[model samples]
Target: MHGKFKGKHAIVTGGARSIGFEIARQFCAAGAMVSIFDYNQEALEIATTTLTNEGYRVNPFLVDVSDQLQVNLAVDRAEEIAPVDVLVNNAGICLVTPFLNIEAEEWQKTLDTNLSGAFYVAQRVCRYMARRGKGVVLNMSSKNGLDGEFGHAHYNSSKAGLILLTKTIALELAHLGIRANAVCPGYIRTAMNTEVDSDEFVEEFEDRYIPGGRVGKVTDIAPIFLFLASDDAEYINGQTFVLDGGQLAGQKPWKWLLEEIKL
Candidate 1:
């Protein structure tokens, strides 16, 4: 818990804000010389300043994960600082739209960033970890990947692909001591939903669909990522964990059914 990762390094993609930022901070708190990779230049500056001010070491890389060349270069640079002992494939974009309203370009962009981007980083990092014969790779999947949503075919498909990608990585790299896994969080409160008018909806969603009657926080999710990255979970790999406040275990609220009239 304390300074176990002092000499090690961790990389967090899309780490400029929200869940990714929280995860990055926790890793730093654990004493890892962490690197934050994000496409937003301003966010990178702010995040870097925040962490460094806390007396934790962090290297920020302006990276668009959808680009393989950038992914390779960023990883290379991160490696120059220290070998990556843990990788959190958290960079992704979610643009909501009905399936019929989805364009080819939108679908491609989502996949490129969410699924393909994870591939690029995971493969590059795993290659390094493979040589060392050990490492942890954690992909940030979503509950949308598990079940269907009203609007988000492209986003759903990308996340769904990540679960399989994680499995494949685990199976292929098991002999190499590189563990891969995914976390599916449901209805977590974050700034990613600005496009949607969901203040009232979220309250209802929590009270109804989510059995726990509350939404999740980054604090609720960040600790798990650190756990998976640690030796305690050395025996756990190639699996997906759902942190949804019991939402996945329950059924939809009456409002959802009323909207569709399944019968």
Candidate 2:
């Protein structure tokens, strides 16, 4: 119950599970009164109960960040606990559909949830931070955002847009004592990804993309996020951190690439 963020308040969208939950848990453990915003009532209940049982302070709100009204009202409610000191913009959804086959509804839903939702949450919470003249915003981007991935045109586009949104937030808000950044994670072992990717697919993905030879764990991501939330990262802003196990490092010619070249 004693750490760098003691007495601070953190708002984590999508905090009901996976990477978001880990971030909220760690923040709560570090003594931040964490407010979790998720659209899922069951998961939210489970997450809040888990933290409260562990002697951590946490509040839960069923918020769909894509809806501005929901975002605004939830922010107001969360502030009743305390002013927002940190915001982890993590609420997002991904549907695996081919680009040519993507529906208008699917495309809109992806952007609305992943990109616009992040915008709504950040805007609402940063206002609270701006008044205090200090706070942090951490947007959850993904490796897919920066690089091309098969079967995720909508998801990829939304995440890519988030990177720029994060940068713009930093540019405008840094002067107000707020810093914004994006975290781009690689093949992390989260339920969201696991549901879409098979066990064999995950192994193959690691063999081809991840140089670390294994998929990343939520543990690999939460610590870096908490770091960005800490005062130690005061000078770091408008930046993107990639935790991809060298997937994007442009490795030397592999079997497929060498065969394609056939020199």
Candidate 3:
């Protein structure tokens, strides 16, 4: 559990906060030198400072993943610090809008950030992995990628595209010893979710939808990223691991019938 990544280098996109931040922290705790890339300068500084203060190796870079030039530059800076052995493409954006009301600009922005950004970051980092003949790429997908959600046309489309993108990367890079995988999380207690949903709604939704009786947390996800990036998961490739507390397992009609009988 400890030092599984000792002496390795990891680059985590969107690592300034939430799930991304937790992943970066876990990697550092496992003894990997970590570089956090984020668009938010203030958050990046704070996270980097906090991790460093905790006696962890951490470097922060301000880069927008949607911009290829910025991603390239950030990779260069990260490589200067250490050769990247693990790349976590965790940066993305979601815009919830009805399909009929979604504007062209909004759709473009969502895809550009969620899909194209992951592509740019992965391609740039995988090139180095290819040269080294070994690396791991973990993409942050969403449960919405597998099932449609209301008022999330753009978000769902981008995540669906990312799943395919992950597969393509895995197939192409497996020959080079670079494994690619995706983690599809549902109802995580992140700022993105809390910002939109009220406390009452969160409590009700968890009770109704999550079979595990609660929504997931950042800790629930970070370890999986570490496992996939570590040597233990060398054979795991081109797979999307859904961590949703069985939310996608479908409703139980038999259970409904039992309830009806009781009524």
Q: Give the per-residue lDDT of model 1 (tens digit) for 146-235.
A: 986877999999999999999999999999999999999988788787457478988877777887889999899999899999999999
Model 1 pairs whose backbones collide: none
RMSD of each: 4.4, 3.4, 2.2
**lDDT value for model 1:** 0.92
lDDT tens per residue, model 2, 115-148:
9999999998989889989999999999999996
When summed lDDT is taken over every stretch of 10 residues in candidate 2, the lowest stretch is: 250-259
Error of 1 at 33 (Å): 0.9
TM-score-based ranking, best first? Answer: 3, 2, 1
Q: Which predicted model would earn the best TM-score?
A: 3
Which pairs of residues collide in model 2?
none
Cα error, residue 227 of model 3, in Å, equals: 0.5
* lDDT value, candidate 2, whole model: 0.92
Question: With candidate 2 superimposed using the best TM-score fit, by how many Å does residue 237's alpha carbon deviate from the native?
Answer: 0.5
| Candidates by lDDT, descending order | 1, 2, 3
What are the per-model numbers of colliding residue pairs? 0, 0, 0
Residue-pair clashes, model 2: 0
lDDT digits (tens) for residues 1-263 of candidate 3 = 59888999999999999999999999999999999989999999999999999899998899999999999998987888889999999988877799999999999999999999999989999988899999999999999999979999999999999999999999999999999999999889997777888989988887778877799999999999999998899999999999998889875344566577753
TM-scores of all candidate predictions against the true structure: 0.94, 0.95, 0.95
